[model samples]
Structures are given as structure tokens and as C-alpha cells.
Target: MVALSNVRFGKRNDEVKAIQAGLIAVGMNIPAGATGFFGEQTRSAYAAWQRVLGFTGSAADGFPGCSSLAELGARAGFVVDCRNPGAITKSSVRFSRNSGVAVDEATARAFAEQACDRTGAPRSWVTGVSNGANLLTLVFRESSFRPNAVNRDDVNATGPIQSDGARLNCSRGYAQVIPDTFAENHQAGTSDRIYDPVANIAAAINYIWRRYGDISRVQQANPHRDPAPY
Candidate 1:
């Protein structure tokens, strides 16, 4: 980390000089007689390159401070790692043309279809078919649709109920639960679906009776996870 830090600030070091050279080679628009300081001008150029690749972050100073730039570079076929601090970053796009996510249109369609099947949602509601499809997002974002990823360990939760970090307690998977006492009381119904995407999806649609379902309670039973009464 320190080695790269020095490389970023050197005035006469050729390696540092080389970095500035590459930045200029790609049209950095530096000031006249640039002294290899890796200053604002160079940062602007780096930031511009990052934007071209759809990264989301700022380029302040010249350190590439563990921001969106590193991740952007990584996603754009670069082995760039933010944790490494300063190191020689290489772009995968430069050497290997056959890189990037492997998912293709056909496969994505199949995956979407499978996701819909698992959710038991109408085939017409699937993407490219449904008017407002949300099954895929629910599976991927909230639960990863994998029972193993339920995140049973994350206990320091601020939200009412969380299925790990993805599915907020109030907002159930795919359903986007509303935060309310009644909503929280309904969480028990989802325990069975802790890892079953299909079951979880079905539970969301049931939206069992809320206001009228349990009027004899201190507050409305947790509506999102209300347990059945004996």
C-alpha cells in the first residue's frame, strides 16, 4: 500500500512519471509543462475514464481512494482491487476480449421463467410478458432465492425484522412490506419459507386478513409475519 502511495506522489520517479504519461497519452488535458504530480488534471482524466465504463464515484486528489472507481475498473474487466491500496492495476478488457458476465439473453429468459415458476406467479406476469413483474428482483435481491443465504446470523438489526440484510422485516420479499405493528406480527408465517423461494413468494400474495383478522390485540398483530392463532 505504501509503495503505491509513494508512486502516486513522486516528483522524479519514472514509474510515477509513466502513470502520468499514460494518462496524458489518453488525452488527460493537463496544464502546460506537467511536472508529474498526479494532481487535479490527472484525476479528472481518470474520473472521465471511469465514467465511460459506468462506475459511480468521484476522483478527488489522485489516489483512486477506495471509491466506485476501483469497483468500476473491476467490473470493466480490470483486476483492480480497492483493498490493495496502491498497486499496478491491469485491465482485463485490454488482454482478454472474451470476458464479462456469462449470462446471455436466452439463459436470462430461462432463468426468469424458472423464477416465475418458483414464485407460482402467472406466466403472463413474467418479464416480457407481465405488466409489472417483480419476481426476479425479489429472488435475486431479497433472498438470492437460495435458502442457504437467509442470513440468519445478522442480529444487530435496526429494521423490525430482516431475513438477513436483503429482505427487510416490514417489507417482505417481493411484496415490499409496509412498516407497522401489524406487519411485524405476521413474520411467523414466513419461517417455513426461510429458504423456500416458492413458499415465500406464495406467502407474500396471501396477504392474510390484517385489520379485521385480529382486532382483539393490544396493537394489530405483526401483519407482515402474523402467526396463526391456536
Candidate 2:
């Protein structure tokens, strides 16, 4: 799901149209048929839905928060939970990650081989010779370090400001990939799961291959040219 707007009464925007559609789909009486405008009727229906969801007073003041938008989206046949690593396929949701998902030995080997082949990195190093294993081990260690592990949330994460003085929010996923180097590099999934091991590893490998070309290049680069803030 894309980022939802935090909309309330008196605001008129394109996001309001999605909200109106969701409200109407959930059986709300949006008589104007999803007008981009937020009027009294939209507010009343939204408040009533909020009350039904057990919120009262200010909490039910017809303002749409993330949770409320998610619930509304669910009712409208959309899956809005960013944490769910699942796909809409074959008329059912297929979960991509399970309790045991991780950077197993096989996955690491295949990833390294692919990276070496794609980037023309030395076969020995890409196959975990010298400091190559260290890179692979970092992902493994991070994925094993927490209960959520690879599913760790990277949304709203911040890294130390970069040399260019941009307060980069590029750290993400099990490999903690910084993906600003490529255009439209995001995987086809929810935004928050940029940290999921499968997605993170793929994105990180691609970023490394694209940005630094090969591990040897990264090793030879000036230390002061580090892109990572940490």
C-alpha cells in the first residue's frame, strides 16, 4: 500500500478521493460519489465508522490515521498492512516470509555467485574469500540478532548525516542497504518490508553491484568517501 494521507475535515486533495472510495465501499453514505472534497457528510460517515470500531470523542473525530485508513482499505478489498510480507496471487494471499526465513548457507552462496558473475568481481572474493565472507556474515548476524530480525521495520529510520549534509534515511533491511543510487529500485511489495531478508538481500546486492561495481572497488575507494553515515 502507498502512504496514506492524514486527512481530516475541510481538506481537499487527491488522497481524499481514495478515502471517499474506501468509505463508500465500506458501506458509508458518501452521497457525492468520492468527490475529491471532504465535506460534512464524509466527516459524519467517518465518525460513525470510527465509533463502530470502538473509538469515541476525539479519537472518533472523523480524522483518518494510518490504522483507520488500513482498516478502511481492508474493508474495501485492499491489504494495507505493510508488515505482511505477502502477495496477492491466485485469489489468495501468499506469505513470502516464514518463521525460519534467513540468509542460509545456500542462499548466501547463490547470492555471492550471482554478484560475482554480474559485477565481474574476482570469483575468489565473491565466493567468500578474504573479506567477502565478512560481508555475508554481517547480514547473517543482523538477521539473527533480533526476534523480528529480517522483518525489522526501517520506515522512518534515520542515519547520521552524509558528507553532502543530507540527513539520509537510506538505511534499510537485514543488510541495511542504502538504495539512493538507483532510480525506481524498490521491490514490488509494501514499503515497510524494505527490511525483509529476501527483499533486503536482493536490493543490497543490486545496490552494491551498481554503486561500487565490485567489492574490490569498494575496498580500494578512499575511506573518507564512505557513503554510509554509520
Candidate 3:
């Protein structure tokens, strides 16, 4: 285990840098110019990591406890509970993609709720179609980066829709917001903020809602596509 000292804003140490590196390695967004100093930016990034790991409220406070440090260090996959962060299930979206292992029902439900909340779809709609719809995000996520990452080559890309014929100049974060989508839907920010999980998910849901209306419609439109079982 990497021994890390308790850190808060204003501390400067290699451990702080290590923490930043760990979080970044796991797809959390630390500033590109992040120095070894623990500042508000680092704390905010840390909190975002906690949120992904299913921590919320006081538990989501931007502090690095031993467990959080270990989680960062381990680089194990984490699941975000849309119900709340209080009940996190450790599942790997990467593993499911790479190994063809299906995500568990709980994770599917979480994704269903999260997606529905943004689209104003009924919980039952997602639950009914969660088996297939969840896979779209999971499989599509394979082509996506963490909220902080972008394809180096595609950084300058601008397109409204992602397609094979056109260069896929858009895709980042969990939901993979393409350039055109970002221009139309994003709140206003470029670079790292576009990769923010909340921002990306919101943009993704918005895109999906605008295109498909609801989860059931999404399934209807893409009947042959299959990523996992419900």
C-alpha cells in the first residue's frame, strides 16, 4: 500500500501528486496542469471521484481517507448508484466490455434510474428495457473516455453526429458527448468540463431523449443491437 498522508487544500507533497495521478489514472479529471499541490481543484476532482464511487452528502466530502486512497490506488472499477451513493456496487464497465461479462441487475437499475431522471421517463420504462438500453451506454462507453479524457487526434474535431463515414471527432466522458452535441447541449465550457461525468451524462441523456424520446423508443429504434441481457 502506498503510504499517503492526510491531505487538504494547500498541502504540497509527492503524496499529493501521487493521489492526483491515481485519480487521473482511474479516469477522474485532475487539471491538465495539476501540480503536486492540493488545492481546490484537486479537492473538487477528488470529490468527483467519490461521487462515482457512490459516496454522497457528507460521505462525499472531498477528503482522502485511507479507503478512498486505497480505491484510488487499486484502480478497481466502481459503480455509481443513481439511487444514491450510499449503496455502491463495485462493478467494472471496462470488464464487461473487455471480457463480455454482463453488468449486474443492480448496476443496470442504477443506470436505468440515472438515464430516466434526465429524460423524464418512468422508472418502469427503464426497468423494462434496462437489459438492452444499459448495454448501449456500456458498449458505447467503450469508445468513450473518462470525463477528463479526450482522443488526442479528435480534439479539434467538430461534427453534429457520430457516424462511420465522417471522422468521429466527438466522444469523451462516460456518455461520449460528440462535438455537435456539445455545441448544442452543453452548458458552456470546453476542454475538461465537457468530460465531467455529470455534464457528460446530462448531455448524453439530452441527446438520447431528443433523438429517441424514451428508453422504450430507443429499444424500438435499435431492435437488433444487443450488448447484454436484461
Clashes of 1: 18
Q: Which portions of model 2 miss their true places by more than 4 Å?
A: 79-230
Score every model by TM-score: 0.25, 0.33, 0.34
Per-residue lDDT of candidate 2, residues 68-105 (tens digit): 76788778755453321222222121112235544365
Report every candidate's CA lDDT. 0.35, 0.49, 0.48
Q: State each model's C-alpha RMSD to the native.
A: 22.9, 18.5, 18.2
In candidate 3, position 134 carries an lDDT of: 43
User: Which sequence of candidate numbers ranks them by TM-score, best first?
Assistant: 3, 2, 1
Q: Residues 1-230, candidate 1, lDDT per residue (tens digit)? A: 11222233223354445555555565555664345565556556655655654555322323343343344334433333222121112210011111232333343335445543543334443342212333343334444333233342343123433424442432332222222321222223233332233333333322221211111220112223333321
Q: Which ten residues in a row have the lowest lDDT in candidate 1?
A: 89-98
Q: Per-residue CA lDDT of candidate 3, range 91-111, in tens?
A: 201111112223454443454
lDDT of 3: 0.48
After TM-score superposition, what is the CA distance of residue 10 in candidate 2 from its true location, in Å? 2.8
RMSD score of candidate 1 (Å): 22.9
**In candidate 2, where is summed lDDT lowest over 10 consecutive residues?**
86-95
